[model samples]
Target: MISGPASVRERRLWMRTIAIVNQKGGCGKTTTAINLSAFLASETRRVLLIDMDPQGHATLGLLRDPSQLEKTVYEVLTHEQGVTALAEIIVRVRENLDLAPADVLLSALPEKLRETPGKENKLSEVLEEIRKDYDYVIVDCPPSVGLLTFNALKACTEAIIPVEPSFFSLQGIARQMETLDLLATTAGHNIKARALITLYTGRSDFAKAVAEEIRKHLGDRSFNTVIRFSLKLPEAVGHGLPIAEFSPRSSGCADYRALAREVLADEPPKFAPSRVEEDPEEAIAPAPAAALEQAESPLEPRMQVSPPIPVIGEGLFTVETPRAREEANSLPPAAVLEQAESFLESRMPAAPPMPINGEGLFTSEAPGAREETIPPALAAVFEQAESPLERRIQASPPMPVNGGVRFTIEAPGARSVQLAADFNDWVADEMQSRDGIWTKVVPLPPGRYHYRYVVDGGWQTDPLNVHLEPTPWGGYNSVFVLEGNNGNKVH
Candidate 1:
């Protein structure tokens, strides 16, 4: 059981809930749901896989016998007296992973709840009670459009339609997308839907052509990672174990891990407000007196201030802007700024004095000191410094020594931190902490790489590193380039 302080769990408004839906069977829908949930759990996230399909394939995939269970999602959704709590049916299947098994009885849920009010929201209401307990919930929908699928769609904020590389699969996806759009409009909930190519055979020309056609039609709406055909996948499923544990080095495991990384790189989809019926009289009501008075007044002209222009001196001193100069002059004579500057000057390396010209403040000779000394108080102000030299100094990029680079970040209150990068195949490696500063060292050859820090199950870019590139998922990845015995931060 993954438990945390109430305060910590409450940091997220709701866990990311995704429903795997496809009206067409044998399209790898159940396979994607099971494997994706497993890989996400392996990434140190608490995940729950709910088998909405009465066939109980997801439960069996995790090696559980749904028939022998005392309770399952069927009881929770269709109980006569009241709905059963979701927590009671949850069974721990693996580390950081749980399952809500289903059996043949779940197939009767549609008829049982046909006359019930708000029947389509039964699953949604049940999940709302424990939404903060897990990081993700994966709902495996049955291979048909019915009440179960409606409940899954109503409860989820995102949907993934897994399609095999074939013309039939492609044709099925169009209908699936249409259904998703109709649900989103009628339910007034925005759902982010993506297409994933599964069961792909890279060597086959037909498969390659179909994959290309899917990509061209979906554009950025399709996943880049394709689930290639692998014999080991079914073997793992038969054993009721994830590919990560059964065959860690198999292509099936590699592809799923890559898919999990892509999922983590993106932020959770935001939930849209549901449609509410309002009276026509209230919809066009006249504005209140106070609102009307405020709107009638002329809008104030906003003041626009230009950015400060930097002027570098012989000792790398920067001149303050006119507004800054006035603010500094207003301070007390014994202000801390003067004392800090004096302390920094005393600690700086010795440099040759330059003759200052009267009018243009020209320097007769360059300073011998190669680096500028920054005052403690001024460091914060220089955070947005425009000059390359100033920015580099402020960033304090990690240096590579003896073919190893030391990665460090200060996260004062984080429970744990891990490093994930392309060099490690995107598997998060636990980082050690000392005095709230997390550190890790990885050996690498001369090459460029992108990375991110996983702080307490949340993906974050290194705060100290200024170099970053935008990810396709609407987030940034910190960039690092190792050259010889030195490391350079790059964008």
Candidate 2:
């Protein structure tokens, strides 16, 4: 809809360009790109999936016959004689989702563009024309690194490297990361690269161990959503449909949806009113000098900016120490409230030496003989007492009521929390939050269960329940046993 270069530049600011790249084959790179785009589009976002891979797996996965296509991304990128618009090759795959299909002919791109001066920037330049048209542009790179992959890296602002739970996959990731770092240093492009664990089978000890190692090393850099191995996934692709359409109830569909939500969560907020007057062209430019300076090293997370304030209220009062403020800002609302209560308790005397009036008010005795009563509303605010929810969570482990187990965790500051357990095939179930406590009541018969909590995209064992079992990977999982109708904490 945006016409001319200026309007395109303005629209590009809101668009998220992501390239799915992995030098290793059979790592679910194409599958991730296709399904992720489909799920994103299902969420009411306009998505354009560009098949940069010459093999055309993404195109075939969407049921688009590349052989019949007169125009593809290859044609648009080559532009042998005259310029070919990317929109001309795009075909609608689903509602709100479009595809620019590719075929084996694209494999010749490197040899053709080798003589071109700005060949690496071809995809980047071509994408500019339709930058304003879609909310997301997902590029499916070839399995091997070449000019095509370089073009993808050059164009995208974010990259996802899908690493399956295999020894070979693990070895390849280090090389893949090195390539990304090389590009960042040489090209000076700021691309936020993240590792996605795919084709994971939790039942296999080897798979679990590999996954744990990836998480341990990557930490927050790796996605918390793991794509569990599913037979329905390959079957759906064979049927020329995404897992969501082919088997909506399948684990494959659920995992991809979770991945899409994780990606959407990281979307940057829109520019403030004050930044409206800034030049649009400059917004799409490479990282500024300030951003570069913030990065301690190229391997570290780039473009380091102060984390956004938590949704909870601002600090209780002006913080005197930078370290204290930083620690407070990182804490969830529940922790912050506890800290405030402790601060209040430390400042107040153990006994006020005041008398309770007939109206249940605290009356202070003074030399002037004037009765000063504490207001009920004001007094309630200053009360250093735990809420009923907090007390219940602290007093008991998951309680079984009405043939269901109620799991609870105190994390008031977390924007979202999910419970994943072996009983549910490790699929994360959203938990409801009240005050600073999160609870999920699941109906279960007598059985043993292993579970973990995912808070704000970080996975961890339940802190409340000390009884934990060591996992295959050097981590722990909380254990709970339901005997008859009553729940028992596993020792």
Candidate 3:
């Protein structure tokens, strides 16, 4: 199949397809699917939520009663010519958001496709016809693996697995990863999977500990944001409305927004690495000094340096001087007597001195008088130092009026990151990442500018900068404000 755009203008309108799946029930799979989709749509982008499950929880969660719907996903999948009239079946849940409803009739999808050839690719084919119409398409998969789930897997570019903080859910993660591996081998589909923690109660020590364990094992595959448990979530579902619409101020709404921000920050997930090979001899480590010296370079070196020896107490025996023997032979009788007297004096203890408050250097009527005035000698020293003849005027460094703006970002997985914005007309001026950190300094006049990091064909906001401007494309532009004033705050 052909991938990427045929023209430069057409490349900006590409779509992302995602599937939310987990075999375990009551793990908040459907909840994540609905809320995440709702938050993305809230950003003013066209989003389609596909309810592929027969239970139709995603459909019910979005205020669409499956019983009242005439043509649902069940009909869309069973009919041979249903792909042509998909627009008729899809209902608009709200502005910039649409839903392809499903009902219990969807449970019979497997038997319906039993005799059909290439059933696995049927859903992918159907979605291909309308994929260009929206920015994102989210598929809500069922709890069990079957023809329906396989079709969804074939259609999706990425998968999100929601897991609860419990032992049962923790054990299910390995099985899910194994299933993805098998699908990749048998079906030739590389679907990127990310594990999300849902229904997390931060107050529970056991839950927090289990969540940390899952994150430690999953590494980068697990999301940084945890969807906290909130009573408003179930209440919103019962009312047949997404949390954004049902209770906008609730924790459920805040958690989903945070999740959406993370989703927008990432590039298209790389499901697998490409083929590459190296010789055994070449793969072996070089000398430590050579490695450390050429660490900034991309390729590994092939030389080694020997270890250095210690200078102090590094060997078994100590060396003696000849001058010490001559001094020992020349000792006198009087010197011996003086050494004995000194030794006896060192062994004796000395008496403590008396208090000098009213007896010695300063005999003042009150203790405050000593503290209030410095000694005459010290006062003279301070007076000379404070004199204008001794004072020096130091020069200050000049403030930056207009100069280069150093833009840096760390993207270890990216092939190359380019600075694209109004300054450069969004061109891919390549910048190489050294030690996983990419940097580029561009000279510009002091003013506000909007920019983004385009890493390996994926556009992302600057993670280092908190100042952002929402774009019409349902994302953001990293904003930088440089000023001539020395004390100006950065944006």
Off by over 4 Å in 3: 1-12, 80-84, 267-491
- For all predicted structures, in order, the TM-scores are 0.53, 0.54, 0.52
Given candidate 2, what's the lDDT at residue 432? 91
- Reference-based lDDT, each prediction: 0.65, 0.66, 0.61
Q: Could you tally the backbone clashes for each prediction?
A: 0, 1, 1
The positional error of residue 124 in candidate 2, measured at the CA in angstroms, is 0.2
Regions of model 2 farther than 4 Å from truth: 1-13, 81-83, 270-491
Q: Which of 1 and 2 is the better model by TM-score?
A: 2
Q: How far in Å is the alpha carbon of 138 misplaced in model 3? A: 0.2
Off by over 4 Å in 1: 1-12, 80-83, 268-491
**Highest-scoring model, lDDT:** 2
Worst 10 residues of 1 by lDDT: 351-360
Per-residue C-alpha lDDT of model 1 across residues 1-491, encoded as one tens digit per residue: 11222233443465889999988766678778889999777656779999998777788788545556888898898764464799988999988899989876788998999899999999999998778788789999988899999999999999988887665678889988988888978988778889888766433345556777887789878876667555456556656878777655455665676677667656333322122222332121221233223322211211111221233554333444454545544666435343322222122111111101001111112334222333333343433443222222111234454458778777779999999999999899998887677878788876778899999999997754434566887777877665333342211
- Scored against the true structure, residue 410 in model 3 reaches a CA lDDT of 67
